[model samples]
Target: MNYTAEAPAVWDPEAFTDAEDCLLCADQCVVRAQHYFVKGMIEIPVIGGDETFSWGVWVSISRDSFSRAADLWDTPGRESEKPSFGWLTTDLPVYPATTLNLKTYVHTRPVGERPFVELEPTDHPLAVEQRTGISLDRVREIAAAVLHAGEDAQR
Candidate 1:
């Protein structure tokens, strides 16, 4: 039998930091897409009436994890809590499906000569319901925390 070695995956510098961050953690954990499994759901604040939304979470494997996804998912444990990768979003301040369309694959590079792969709103309802503006700020906060943690670890 013949086998081929896989190339190591490099994390996206835009989405991740040299230090620890949410994107970095997510990348290390192997989250490829922010999948919305459920529809029209929201998360509530501890004190405020403000609600958070969730479609669901999508976890994708890297070439590194391709052989391990089955083993990991099959084993006892929920994927979200121990997700391949994920991000939680709020229901309020939601971006209209029309407003937030993915023009190209922001997270991944093409395997061949393809310039870009665009995803439309109809392609998947949750695919276009991206969190932006303030929501993105929140995401950045989480990433900052992760980055801070990583820096602390180095010291």
Candidate 2:
């Protein structure tokens, strides 16, 4: 199933009520994907001393997404061996291509800047501000709650 990069909801301050939630969500979304789920994070140094990283996320069907994923997945000498983040479906014989592993190439922030600053997808007004230097208070607040929950070990 080929897919496209749909920016996730803006990181809500309230949505992340505690550190545990932040850590857990981030861990599940990225670290775990790389460490245990066979996905990988590849970093490439761009001209300006800035680096771009491909945090494999999903797959695509067209040149736009496919090209972007390909650029992110690019590495010297072993382009064909790069990982696949999504799959394409096709009808065929006994060994049809039923599955295609797609990888999400999440862009990293420019040097000394924050990542995802230009890609906020939500109705939250705070998200707008966040792109312009505002801190994510809602996420911090939720992170606090997550920590408390962990401390109490609620049922």
Off by over 4 Å in 1: 1-52, 57-60, 77-155
**Best model per TM-score:** 2
Over 1-155, each residue of candidate 2 has an lDDT whose tens digit, in order, gives 11112212222345444534342232122121221111122222223333332222222223443344335433433332333333222111111232233223233333322122122333333223223332245334434654675578565
Worst 10-residue lDDT window for candidate 2 reads: 87-96
> Which whole-number lDDT from 0 to 100 does residue 51 have in model 2?
34
TM-score of 2: 0.26
Residue 73 deviation, candidate 2, in Å?
2.2
Candidate 2, overall lDDT?
0.29
lDDT of 1: 0.29
Off by over 4 Å in 2: 1-71, 74-117, 120-123, 135-142, 149-154
